[model samples]
Target: MLIEPLLEIRDVSKTFPQPRTLLEVLARQPKRTLHALRGVSLMLRPGETLGIVGESGCGKSTLGRCLAGLHTPEGGEILWRRQPLSDIRRADRSRRIQMVFQDPYSSLNPRMTIAQMLDEVLFVHAPSMSSAERRDRTDSLLQMVGLSPGLKNRLPHAFSGGQRQRISIARALALEPEVLVADEPVSALDVSVQAQIINLLESLREKLGISIIFIAHDLNVVRHISHRVAVMYLGQIVETAATETLFGNPQHPYTQALLSAIPVPDPDIRSLQVGVQGELPDPLSPPPGCGFSTRCPFVMDKCEKPIPEFFDSGGEHHVRCIRAHSSTFSVPA
Candidate 1:
């Protein structure tokens, strides 16, 4: 039997209008809009971890926010278990999906103790619970993320970065969410702490059977944790495939370049470097056709005219480049 997606994003698009100057407004200058996400789509299966990797401004966080219901999309549909996400009640949605933000220090309340923070989540979501029950639940959440209940009374400023992140995870779990949108959860921590957080997230996924959308710029981390990976560029997904397939046999030029950038630990084995031509284009005025057309090494006349549709390279592998169908296509030296 085939299983349906737990969450689905169909042709989602989001744009932010640039703040206009008083002079520009008086002069009747056209308002410029930054296209953060353009016709992006993806699916997350139940109990699956989908990794979204891209450059700094490539809409990774924007996509995560959209999934967590933090930002409403300007276009397209986000479906939850075959139902529209907008139709879901806010309280129900919060209980089902939660977000672990990038900066643990900033995400938490500075004044509130850990217990107070967790208690707030439970108070809002599980108002039926008694005060004693809520206290017990908060302690359980702290213990669940590998923190001691004794630390619950401490302020956010007292903990280390990794410890604070674990606290953030605990707070997110207070609602018993089935899906976790982890937006660069480990990016700001120390290298050793990063591994610890990654293991914590992996362990939580296994123990709680929760699906995760892991977004980050770290390719190695994504490969280590993700079953499937999606490569985004300038508000569009250029390629997506299983972790090994995308790393082993990248089809899109942009994906190949990204994989090529991963450093080889051993100096004896030199890796082939694939360089992209130019900088990322301005989102307010993107290139006419494919977003990567200007920077792609294998660009052709046709790639500059019409936007390429996703082509199935094989099982579960999809590419959005026009050259995806070509048998002889390979990254240039």
Candidate 2:
């Protein structure tokens, strides 16, 4: 049986103008822009968690923002349930998609009590609900995220870091969104707290059956929660496959380098670790051809000619590297 995607993104691209200082502007300097996302496309199935992992400055957060309607893509189509995202009513869009930001402290308002915060969401989405009904729903939202209803009267500052994150999650759930785009939700918390939050998310997903787009730099966390993984590089998806296939049989050189860099627990293997060399190219003036060519150990003359389109190796495991087709190709350890 074929399953239709809950959401689809096709040929999406976004760019931001680079800011110039007053002196440069006065001198009539040519304006430049950062290529944040380029021809990106992906499918998200209902009730499935898709994990997007990449290095810093790779535009992971920008992609998330585009999906959540925070940034409009200059090109390409975003469809929700086969309907154009732009055509969807604003109120319906809010109820169907929600975002959980990285910093819980910064995302919440300090002046508003927890109850008031949730109440505002209900006020906008469920305006007809009576005060008593709204209060009941707010309490339910608090308890849904493992927070106590009693804490609704307190301000955000009174809670611990983990508790504050739980509140953020609760606010997102208040709208009853079908899709949740969580951009580094646990990255700012302590390591122990991160585990707690990750577990909470997993539990919530099972209970609510909501689809999630989890964006983060931590491979282990992505591996634990994501059914499939998409590795991004320089604003483009380089590889995507089932989590086990990606970890056990990585094909692209970039993916291989990332897997090799995961820290091994054995002290004997610690000294033998290897990582990718060279820094990422500047986005404002990216090099021609493949973005990973400069750092790819298996670089070829063909790689410098043009960027390769994604090709399925087998079983829908797709890769963009031209060298990925060669059975003998391998990244040096």
Best by TM-score: 1
Residue range with the least summed lDDT across 10 consecutive positions in model 2: 266-275
Q: What C-alpha lDDT do the candidate models reach, one value each? A: 0.91, 0.88
Point out the worst 10-residue segment of candidate 1 by lDDT. 264-273
Tens-place lDDT digits, model 1, residues 106-214: 9998999999998888887898999999999998999999999998899999999999999999988888899999999999999999999999999999999999999
Query: RMSD to the native, candidate 2?
Result: 2.2
Candidates in order, TM-scores: namely 0.96, 0.94
Off by over 4 Å in 1: 265-272
lDDT of 2 by residue, 195-270 (tens): 9999898889889989999999999999999988999999899999988888777777788788768966765444
lDDT of 1: 0.91
Candidate 1 — which pairs collide? none
